[model samples]
Target: MHTPAPTAPAHARPRAVHWLTTAAATAAVIAGAALLQPAAATASPDTAAAAQARPAPDAQAATYPLECRGGAPRVVNRATGDLDGDGHLETVAVVRCDAGIGTPPSGVYVLTSPHRVVATLLDPGDGENVTEIAVAEGAVAATLLGYSSDAVARCCPDRMQKVKWQWRNGKFTRSATPDARGV
Candidate 1:
C-alpha cells in the first residue's frame, strides 16, 4: 500500500497545457518575423506604387551628356574598366538606334551609374555603324564601319574608320586615328 497516489490518472489537462505552450511559442516566433521584415517587403502594394511615383533623389539621379531616342537604346557591345582612373569601375556600352532602313545610328556610352549615360564616346550618324568597341588605357577605341558614301547600299559596310576616345575635362573627346581600313 505505499504504492501511490495514482498520479492523478495522467490528467489530460497537462497534455492540453503542453499543446497550448507550443502553440503560443510558434505564434510569437511568427509574429516576430513579420515585424522584423524589411520596410519594402512589409509595405502594401499601394504604398510601393506611391514610392515609385516620387522623383529620385539628386544624389541618385545622374545627368547624362547625351539622350537616346526612339526607345531605350539597344546595347550591342559592352565592356568594363576604370575609364576615368576613378578607381570605380565604369561601363562602356555600344548602343544602337533603329532609326530607319539605312545603317542604324550608334554610339559608345560610358556610365558611372547604371541609370545614366555619363559620356558619349563615339556617335555615328544615321547611316554609320559601330562595328567594334574596346576599352584600354582609360580610353575607348571604336571602329566606325559603314558605307563609303551615301550612294553605297545597306548590304555591308565598305569603309572602316578607327577612332579613339579619351576622357578629358570631365567629358569625352574623339580623335580620328590614321588606321582607316577597308572591309
Candidate 2:
C-alpha cells in the first residue's frame, strides 16, 4: 500500500492562489486606511499667534460675543473673530457648512445655546427651528432667515472667498485670502 501521493506541479495547481493573494492584499490596504487617523492637531505658529493675539475666551465675551460653533454646543474660545463671518465663526461651525440654526447639511455645524438648537422640526419655523443663527460679518440681517421645507445647495457659505491656497507636500494649505478689491 503505499507511497504517499506526490505534490502537484505548479502548472497543475488551481489559480485560486493568485486570486486569494490579490483579495487579501486589497483588504489589508483598505483596512489600513480605515484605521488610519489624522496626526494630532499640533499647534502651528499661526495657531500660537492667534491664541496670543486674541483676548482670553471669557474676557472677549462682553466685547465681541465671541460665539463658537464647533465640537458640541460649548462656548467659543472667547477672543475669536467672525471667522469667515458667514455670520458664525469656524469655532462654532465645528467645520465648514455649519448648520447654525437647524440641522444643516452634514459637513459643518453651527453651535447655538445648549438648549437653542435642540429640536429643528424642519421649517417648523415660527422661530422653533429658526434659532439665533450666525451670519457673515457684513451680511444683511434679513439673510439670517432660516430654511423650512428643505436645505438647498443655496446653503453653501455665502461669504465671498478669496482663498489663496498652496500645494504643500502634496496637500493644499491656505495662508490667507487677500483683501478683495471692493471687499
Candidate 3:
C-alpha cells in the first residue's frame, strides 16, 4: 500500500491559491508591457527625417489629363496619403472643368512628390462626377455620381457608386465597395 502524501492545512490552501493567482497576474502584466513597446526602427534616421521634411504633392500645381472646352481643369477636392507603401505621401485630386452653370465630369489623379501626375485613377470622359474623394491606408476611394441613361439630366445623377483603388501588381486596381448603390 502506498502512503498518502501529506497535504497542506485547509487554512493555508486559500493563501497558496492567492499567491499563484497573483503571480500569474503579474506575469501577464509584464508580457503586456513588453508587447506595448515600440518595434525596432527599420528606417534610418536620415531617411525618416527626409520623409518628414518633404511635403505631399500639391494638387493645384499638377496638370490633369482632362480636356475641357476652353475651360481649365480645377481641383475640387483632394486628399494626401501614402498610396504605395513607400513611406512617402501622395496626393489624390478630384478635378473637373471650370464650368459656368452645368456640372462637368470629374477626373481623379494621383500626384507624387514635386507635383508630378503619376497616374489617372479616373478619366473625365467616363462622364461621372466625384462628389467625395479620400485617400487612406495606401488606397484611394471616391463616390461617383452618374446618369443612368441619356434621358437623365446631368444636374441630377440617378446612379451612385462607391469605388476604391489600391496599388497592386504595378498598377492601381479598382474595386466597387459592397455598399455601392444607386441613389
Candidate 4:
C-alpha cells in the first residue's frame, strides 16, 4: 500500500506559511513596480518627418546686425530650442564685436532655418554683456552683466540682471527674472 509523505512539524508550520507569504508579497511588489514603469518612447512617423524637414539653425553661418567697427562679429555662446512652438528648432546666439581689449557688449539673436536672423533679443547697444545664456521650454534665459553707472569701469560690472524671453502673440516678450540683483 502507498503511504503519504511526512508533513512539516506543527510548530514549523506557521514559520513556513509566513515565509511563503513574505515571498508572495515581495513578488507582488516586483510585479507592481514593473507595471508602474514608464513605457519606452517610440517616435511617430510625423515626428520623424518633421525632425528631418527642419534642423536647428546654424549659428556660425548667420550674419548679425551688429556693427563690429570693421571687426567681425563672433558667436560667443549659443543655445537651441523651438522658441515659437513651430515644431522646428531655432538658434539663440550671443554675438559680440571681436575686440582685443575691454569686454564688448553682447547681442542675442535668434536664427531660423537657412541661417537667417529673425529677431534681436539683446542689442549690443544696450551696454550689457551676456554672462550666461540658455534655452528651455520655448523660452530663452540669460544673465546680463552691466555697470551701475558711467563712472563704473567697463572691466568691472557692478550690476547683474537675469532676464527671460518667451514667444507670445507673434513676438518675443522680455521679463526680468526673480534672481536679478547687484553683483
Best by lDDT: 4
- lDDT by residue for model 1 over 34-83, one digit each (tens)? 99987764644564354345432231233434355664445777776667
Candidate 2: minimum summed lDDT over ten consecutive residues — where? 115-124
Q: Lowest summed lDDT over 10 consecutive residues: which window, candidate 3?
A: 43-52
Q: What's the CA error at residue 68 for candidate 4, in Å?
A: 0.9
TM-score, each model? Answer: 0.55, 0.21, 0.73, 0.73
Please, what is the whole-model Cα lDDT of each candidate in the order they appear? 0.68, 0.34, 0.89, 0.92
lDDT of 4 by residue, 67-137 (tens): 98868899999999889876788999999999988879999999998999999999999999998999999
Candidate 1 regions off by >4 Å?
Answer: 1-72, 98-103, 124-126
TM-score, cand. 1: 0.55
Tell me the TM-score of model 3: 0.73
